[model samples]
Target: EVAVLANQTTFFGESGGQQGDAGVIKTENGAIIEITDTQKKLGALHVHLGKVTEGDVKVGDAAEFRVDHARRSSLRANHSATHLLHAVLRKHLGDHVTQKGSLVAADRLRFDISHPKAVTAEEAAVIEADVNSLIRENSEVTTRLMTPDEAIELGAMALFGEKYGDEVRVVSMGEPVANEHAYSLELCGGTHVKRTGDIGMFKIVSEGAVSSGVRRIEALTGADAANYMSARENVLATVAADLKAVPEDVPARVKALQEERRRLEREVSDLRKKLATAGSGATSGGDAFKEVNGVKLALRSLDGIPAKELKGMVDELREQMGSGIVALVSGDGGKASIVVGLTEDLKDKYSAVDLVRIGVEKLGGKGGGGRPDMAQGGGSDPSQADAALAAIEAHIAG
Candidate 1:
């Protein structure tokens, strides 16, 4: 890295939550040094950090310094918008709101402030609207060099942790609304637009909590704000087209579709339960239930049933048997789900948890847990579902 110190320069150093300037310095001997950043050293002296792209340079060489004007313009708009945002936040959220941090960049601006809770969407909209109102006013932005004490006396908001010299630059914008103080006045050293209208527009992209008692807001300005709105409108138009409705009716149509989907889900669930419990007779002599050791033991392996529905199916089957132990296994894809349930009268004689653990072990599962009356478990091997059922029957008979 090469650091160039010139007697006089126009590059703005990195300070006051704004990024450093980037440009190129060309020496008389055709040496091109690409300056990526400008910074301050020992509270003064702008240090241009870059690398030598071509040729060597010695002391006393005359060079031309050129800055990226487009980038600088964008940065100025965002920095000005940040000041308006700060003032509006203090007005709406009470005087307790103070700037904690910020970032003024070419793409967007981010401001961190002391806030107790998250800023709601409605509040963010209002804050954004207020800032844009000031921009629309096209108020002239003015700057003056004043003593720190005098700036503070004029209600200029000085940021904490910033080292201000004897004379600080104070930026003021918009007309005064109170006791001879402008709408926004702050001690800032960052580049900004000459008029608030130069910001063109303002749109808050997001707002969220950054830390304890602090919130951060990220926003876009100028062409970036316009592009953001256009993208949102396009998304809404696409969704409206798919739903066969206009954009104004999209929300109501979506709500109706959601209600219809929930109704269909309930109907499907009822049909599945009926299909699963079909032909399972209550008598002990049937294929579904067999009398073993003076207890009715029912074991069946089925398909296409979700693991979540297994316990409810087991409950219905146990209720049908009046007094018996019901064990059901349902396999889907490569996985197996098993549920073991006992009637209230037989709970003391047999633990559903122990019986289900035996079945789960056969299906390559480690542990199963539930109350003594009902238990559920699952495993990866569906091919071993029958083996799992047989293991449970064996444990009950043993």
Candidate 2:
């Protein structure tokens, strides 16, 4: 059974890679139930699913739900604050506060709001302060169902691709006067608390991007802000206890730790590069053990060679080894790999892909293709590696 999409508030865990909002719904009889997950389907409306009902419940049962109080409060703290951030942007960065996407989870809220240039730290601080003041004032937030034309007349912003019926919900924040100049008015179906005051505190945690065209931000609200601060305090306490130093000195200790980590990362990266260069092969011609048609060929087991890189190596080897072809098969346990390289003169005479198929078949397994110039294949059989190589060489010789 399905319910009206309008009644069920969905989460922003939608297109932006943000997690769904976790909350709860209240029934008509005052049943407070947990809202574990919220999702959207085909841009209709957010769907809310929760705990199973005890008695048999029908699809059309009339119910009124509130967001999980704590989580929804946190979300409101972040969501409303994001609006202030937009206002501040217009003040400082011009009229480019288009929201790309947003996530208002209980722990933290992320906003992918846009601007041409990066917002300076000073500007960010001003925006944060503006939002904090709004939270401090505890502004009232109210929603009403209005005709689409009426909503636009009231200056409500609607998103593109958001399908609307004859009527839409317009959420307004600030004094409840019939035509008061409110802070924000938008068409949304997500769960939000009744008042801005419900949001305890707000902080802009970080700002970044969703894509090249879209800027992004993350903020903390309500209990999440408190929890984040508390967690940092606990860390500071632990550090002070361990070092026998004041909590204020933890900053110096953290800077030193960060420097050490950077040093280790640089060292590891350099070592990896050196090893890759050292172990990779550049072996030239030594002897041609077999001649296929008029082409000279050699066979051997190759190690530490991935298929892509080996093609270049095979080219150099082919020039020196002979004018024909050189194919190598490497295998360990049940897995086997093969690479074949050929010269331009031999394209019509042989196909590298064909060679791979024959090689895998000879090894009692399966494989596939590539161009006549270079090809690679794999199969299940380590024992088949050497035997398959030898069979291909012999076939060429005959």
Strongest candidate by TM-score:
1
In model 1, where is the ten-residue run with the lowest total lDDT?
A: 279-288
Residue-wise C-alpha lDDT for candidate 1, range 34-84, written one tens digit per residue? 999999878878999999999998889999999988888899999999999
Tens digit per residue, CA lDDT, model 2, 220-300:
877777787789789889988887778988778778889999999677655543332232322213343356566676565
Q: Report the alpha-carbon TM-score of model 1 versus the true structure.
A: 0.91
Off by over 4 Å in 1: 279-291, 298-300, 332-334
RMSD of 1: 2.8
The 0-to-1 C-alpha lDDT of every candidate, in the order given, reads 0.89, 0.65
Cα RMSD for candidates in order:
2.8, 9.4
TM-score of each: 0.91, 0.52
Give residue 71's lDDT in candidate 2 (0 to 100).
57
Clashes of 1: 0
RMSD of 2: 9.4
Q: What TM value does model 2 have?
A: 0.52
